[model samples]
Target: MKKQIMLAVSLALAGLSAPAFADGSGFIRVEAGRADVDIRADGIGNGSDDDTAFGVRGGYWFNPNIAVEGFYSRYYSASYNDGFDTYDVKLHGVGVGLVAKKNFGGNHTGFFVGGRAGVARGVATVEFDGSLEDAEASSAKPYFGVSAGYDFSETFGLSVNYDRLKSGGDGVDVTAETLTLGAELRF
Candidate 1:
């Protein structure tokens, strides 16, 4: 279903007439940074933790102002200790969305903000008295973020962004936040 949606979007983008300001370039972006997951459970205590996270995205600009993007992210595992027990949690997701950007300065060096919605899966494990138990859940969630980049020359650029993924389960609530530095190549 996700692949179908992305293909449809790609075909649609391919068929559109180019806008006056269109760059007519497709770009790929890869990012890596820190991820923080906050957990809340009924019987389990609340805890906040951090780990490594990364993402990759491909997009095409319909014009200088609007674009569509597809992305996949892996938010690394986070471990929490509550004095007597320990918990380990991990999350990953894939999504597609739109971006609205404003190009300023010289050569379209500026910022952008976008929103993405898709499915995410979370796995959590608890260890107590040397015994381990695990629970998992899946959900549809939304992610929002902002980025700033400089288009050096025409085909290459660098960017930094922050994204927050809202995810959870019946008794466990998890939110993953990440800060990423990425390189974009357009062709």
Candidate 2:
């Protein structure tokens, strides 16, 4: 299922690239930030809830005001150690979405605000510390985000983004809120 989702997104992004290249509006972005994670399970209590997070995004602008984007992000990883047993879990996602942008000065450069909504395949992996036992769960969920940024020029920019994401399975549930600083380059 994960493989299928990834392949579909890759093909879609590849198909969208041609028009972007012709119009000089394709973009790639890299971001790093902190994620605050929340975990709930049938038998386990909460542990640490913060971690370092990072992501990569690629997209093509359909026009000056809208774009289709694809992204992969590692939201969080956490571990809990009880007196006798230990549990570890990791969460990540891949998704495709649409973004609507409004530049404050009516130009590509300067202040911009945007909103994005999409469907993501979220995966959670859990492992027992002392035993070689592990399990995996995945589900499709809706994810969304908002962004505010400064575009230094048409080719380079910076932004701050906030995203809400979720994933879970069996008895384990995971949700995360991420704050990131990103740099974008247009080609």
Task: Highest lDDT: give the candidate number.
Answer: 2
Best by TM-score: 2
Candidate 1, residues 120-151, lDDT tens digits: the string is: 33344443434555666655566778877766
For each candidate in turn, the TM-score is 0.73, 0.83
- Name the lDDT value of residue 54 in candidate 2: 95
Q: Which runs of model 2 end up more than 4 angstroms from their true locations?
A: 1-21, 43-48, 83-86
lDDT of each: 0.70, 0.84
Global local distance difference test of model 1: 0.70
**lDDT by residue for model 2 over 1-187, one digit each (tens)?**
6677668867876776554656548889998999998877768766447899999999877776788888999988777888888888788988888888887764588899988898887888879988988898777888999999998888888999999888878887778789999998988
lDDT of 1 at 68: 74
Per-candidate RMSD, Å: 4.5, 2.9
Clashing pairs in 2: none
